[model samples]
Target: MDSRVFRGGRGFAYLEEQDRFLGGTQAPEMSFGFIGCGMMGQEHMRNAQLVGRASLGGVYDPAPKSVDCALEIAARAKGTTKPRVYASLEEACADPSTDALIVATPNFTHLDVMRVATRYNKAIFLEKPIATTVSDALEVCRLAANHTQPVRVGLQYRYKAVYAEAMEEVFGRQSVGRVCSVNMLEHRFPFLDKVGQWNKFNAYTGGTLIEKCCHYFDLMNLFAGGAPEQVFASGSQAVNFRNFAYDNQQADGLDQAQVVVNYDNGVIGGFSLSMFVPGAREELVVCGDAGRLHTVEQAQLGSENQNHLEVWAGESGRSRSSAPTYPSYIAKAGHHGATFYEHLAFVEDLVSGKATGPSLADAFWSVVVGAAAQTSIDKRTAIDIADVLPVTDDIQDLMLCGAGL
Candidate 1:
């Protein structure tokens, strides 16, 4: 193992070395185009500046404000010039200067955006919850599978300091031994306002589960280590946006949900979400025969983010605890610094032409699990994965094995 590896920030050496190494790498600079230019798109713009090799190529959005905000971010970057504002999405996708595309469009428009993006055959970094419906997600997967350029999903939670280290402990070191169960919890404030209030309605956002909880489901699926067998969920449009109307439509998105998933390998996973909580906190716990691993990131009243990881072994072994964190600059880039690493991985794949990180199938299964959970909530019954995903064996194998990006 390299001596410079991140070891839960135990000492100053690891972080110092990490800063030097990540900051010093001479990666090939790559230009990127943006499709949506919404809140998330601007976030990608911010993180792209942190990536030594990534530069803003252009942006396209129906909303002029979004375009202006994205351009402002590009202008603020130290060494980068202002990005072009395209009048149409097609123009942005087909622009020769852009080497890659990042789709940060609304959830419902993903399939449509992808339909156009795939035609251009540029490496794409698509935001999560691939589409509003399972069939649409499957279609997106098919398009990505056929695209020549590498296509990757933005499941960046895999890079969070706590979760990344927890993944290393559970899968890399097998510290927790044979995993038997995985459980997760997220408590946070209600959804923030978006342009036109699209997120407040299931019709536009694919329900709360498909839109908000897919990231956690993706993480759960990865840790479960097998295809999901079934899902049982209970949720409601409890507090936020209730009795609230936009454009004569009431917000029907769920504000609370409890979901359980059973994997084919007999590993079970549970997730709890509360959108009305006072603060923000996320927890992941994995249990195995030998021991258990727990990691958490929490903050209150906009305080400093507290990221922690702990591993416990029974009487026969030792235990350890530590706080894992990224450098302050990186941490503030976006998504608690996860997006920085996500962009790093995307750029690496774009340059090397090797597909790693989250693939299209990962996006599919993540949406599948979320859709199943939404269905379970609607029907008040458990949803079988087989029933939800009734495709041919080849497609099933592709979805289950996660062969391509």
Candidate 2:
């Protein structure tokens, strides 16, 4: 090996003898702890263990069953070591072995969990929708801004191969032609019942728009390349448990919602979400001035499976266009499972002392957009993003939004 390229950590001196010299050596693996062992948490745990890049320090979930389930899965995948289970967030964060923490708790709990995690100087990987309200989300961002450790939000779509290529093709190549209009439709199985008891209450999840469509909203903003000067959106509990309750049926009332956001620029975006789709992919389309892009319906083979992207561009009047082929980036086999690619990217940043993408500041904006959408649904009117997140120089002022002390 070249002496110039090889390096070692402090306290260890490399003694390079002959090329054939044999000695036992190993690199330290990253250790990770998971908070909130819910569905997403379990998925991440499986991925991290399978990736073999990080060892599971322990997992914390208030529910005993969840903690047991997480430990079982971790032991089966890796092996039972001295992993500890805690029923509290403080226990998880205070663990000396924990190098990173994954927050997969309810929307409302994100800020509290993040606040505690930051105090312990742990790198954080928070799940989507950052928080239930804009202010709380902004506080999390503000706290993260002061920390030197890496903080990453779960916008996994950004890590997907097809999605990345599509972005490059649309924005990078400018095939989209300024993106004057965007239409997004996502229909998945109803999460109301899927989330179990949590589905009946919007206080915890922030309804369909904040909890679910927030992803689409973030993606739309990315495609637009900037914040919307204004937004007008209208949504309702048109179908599902809410409507069923009115009809005298015992339902969980978490069914469907549609929202339309109009940007200050000419671009218009529409979102359709429901748990009623029989087959997934129901529809995901992005229309631009120059061309249109679509994902294959029912493209998801598994959580780790990559979806296919089809692009139609090169104008031939309004109706004629050529279809282009794109490869998928989903990994077929890995310990980290589907999320390893993104999670490892986050871990690498933490270990290397580098900044992670989608900074908490940017994620705060996503929460602002989500909260605005929720307000629009409540007031039955279009809400401006600024109204939810008024600009201010002081971080605390931004969080309080000029509210009286």
Candidate 3:
């Protein structure tokens, strides 16, 4: 194999029969201890290899199948040792070989996991929907605030090419002018089977809004530029999982929802979600006084996603539409390539000893909005942000602008 063309830097590589760079410059910089080895946890392992900065130091999960699968992936890397199969979460956190921790446990377990992970004081890459409830998320933030190590939450949707470009157009270039409204839509199949069927119940998954739609709500908060003031939502366990039961427990996860968030900045954000659709599609629309920006990503049952972004300059400027994409290799890593960039950022921040991307505050507000929406559905009324978060003097800085920090 040609070393020049396929070097081990941003990804795995092939080595020449007799080469000097074989084990010299291609070593992974940091090793990550995985607290969960399920679907998203395995994805992080793949992306860490793709970024070529982090190696899987070890993994801890109750399910042997998950740990085996994660180890299978880790074994494919170029210059990393065989990762340890940790006996427990505490063992993973206490291992001296791992430089950081990736907490990808289920939504409900985040708080408990954070409690132990924080005690280790290792840098953490926490998965999205920090917790199942607003109060739990607030506590997670509080734990992070006291920890000395930097914490980067996994709000990876912000890194997708189409959405990233939209952010640039709306925030960087002001291409969309003064944003007045934002709309987001996601149509997809039902949730896949998990190890324990924990996701089939609202008690565990934190309802559909907090479990799945938190990503969209987070984007809405970012685009709308403030904390949501009020949320009115309607949803039900319309179709998916309605007839399903595991271990004699009935499934009650919501399969459809319509949410409208009124931001303190006077921007209205709307979201439409359907988990019973055939394939997958997500679209975002931002309208400003000057123009409008729209981006969409769609995929067939077994095909790759197609992403496109468009900006209309109204009457006074130019209009353009283009496909925003990362390298095919990177995109294949996970989450349409967003997770790869998220790992890259995580590694960079570790090297610089600086925190970037979504902070704990960002994750807290994202959950607050989703929790508020779920409560709105539960009560059949509009829910206020203050009611959801219960802002106190300690957290006052987080809600100061009612928006992305």
Candidate 4:
């Protein structure tokens, strides 16, 4: 760990600035109150230690085991301060020593938690999907937009160096020369057991697309240059057939998803997820007229996702010529690496004033697209993004343009 990694201070300048902005003083080493100290929350605590700036001021979880797991992680931490346990989400958010709140609670309870955290003007690091529905997501964003504190979503893929580099290739260097189309193939395992088994139902998690594939949808939006028209999807429960039975019923969860996005700029993006496959290769391909970039990746996370960008010139096809290998830096055998970088950016924003990162609109639309797709699947028709998001005179509106409302 470098000595001068994240510390940039002038005697509580960040706190004063934060106070001036949000009407509450925030510490330089931002203190976080954990609203849900379950599996993902524990991951956040471990990664918070990796960032080395935040203090775990307090933790609150209904489950005793979850709280214990959080404390166990904190006990092993190096620079991070030990956190106190609390009985409720409000208790944790109300702690004066805390500057921000980390809401890793269940999907349905997200806005319920945010409703409290927003009142305190505490910065927040909320996990993805924002909420189980678009209206709920919009309602929270509407509230947070009025609040003074900064809010960052848990979209860790954007923070990965390899992901950034790949984006750079398509957009930065124009190596791909105006990405015209994008496609992602994600074959993964069925739902693992949650502490409460809430994720097994679509009502709680907003369907498998919103719960899981929001990450990929986010990246697709980026590759599509934020221009979205309409979305259509079809899914089935064929693979996880055993889990859909009475006692083990995963009634609301879909085992397969095939989604296509039609961009206003004529860029088409497609996403497919299959949980039935024994072994599946996860890959993303971004293509343009000049050339293309492709990454053959492993779907099961953890471990540095060691993958290469297969660069091809002229066009993307079986007949196209392959030349010049763009190998990504191989990652060490580790799982928490992505979380650490994302948390660093979030904490760094807390300490050194907010800079551009994942926006509320980004979080909003990612879920909007997925939820709309699920609707499309159910209705058997293409649904417009605006039908879910309801466009207004806003940047978010500008982002989701193309197919007429």
Give candidate 4 misplaced runs (Cα > 4 Å): 1-28, 78-81, 241-250, 299-305, 314-336, 390-405
Name model 3 segments beyond 4 Å from true. 1-5, 8-25, 400-405
- Model 4 alpha-carbon miss at residue 12, Å: 31
Better of 1 and 4 by TM-score: 1
Q: Write the per-residue lDDT of candidate 1 for residues 230-255, one digit (tens) a residue.
A: 99999998899899899999889999
Badly placed stretches (over 4 Å) of model 2 are 1-28, 78-82, 192-196, 243-254, 297-306, 315-338, 390-392, 395-405
Q: Give one digit per residue, the lDDT tens place, for model 2 in 1-405.
A: 322113323323445434322332333377889898878888887667544567778888887777888878777842346468876788899888878898888877888888888888777889987887776776777777676577788876555555566677777776656577666677665553333456455777766667776667777777766556666666555555554432343444345666667676667777777666554563446677777776543434244323566667767233322322322212432211236667667767777866545556556666667777777777878787767774556655544542211
Of 3 and 4, the candidate ahead on lDDT is 3
Q: How many backbone clashes does candidate 1 have?
A: 0
Instruction: Evaluate residue 288 in candidate 4 and report its C-alpha lDDT on the 0 to 100 scale.
Output: 88
What are the per-residue Cα lDDT tens digits for candidate 4 across 186-278? Answer: 886677777768887889899889998888898898888855679999987776644454456556688898999998899999998988665
lDDT (CA) for every model shown?
0.87, 0.65, 0.87, 0.74
Q: TM-score for all predictions?
A: 0.92, 0.79, 0.94, 0.83
Candidate 4: give the clashing pairs: 302-335, 303-334
Off by over 4 Å in 1: 1-28, 392-394
Instruction: Estimate the TM-score for candidate 4.
Output: 0.83
> lDDT score, residue 130, model 2?
84
Please provide, for model 3 over 1-405, each residue's C-alpha lDDT reduced to its tens digit, 9 standing for 90 to 100: 322235545554354535645443556888899989999999999998777778788899999899989989988865568999888888998998888999999998999999999898689889988999887887888788788788889999999999989988989999988889999999998899998988898899888899888889989998998768999999998889878999899998999999999999999999999998888999999999999999999997888789999999978478999999988888888889999889988999999976568778878878888899999999999998888775677568555632333
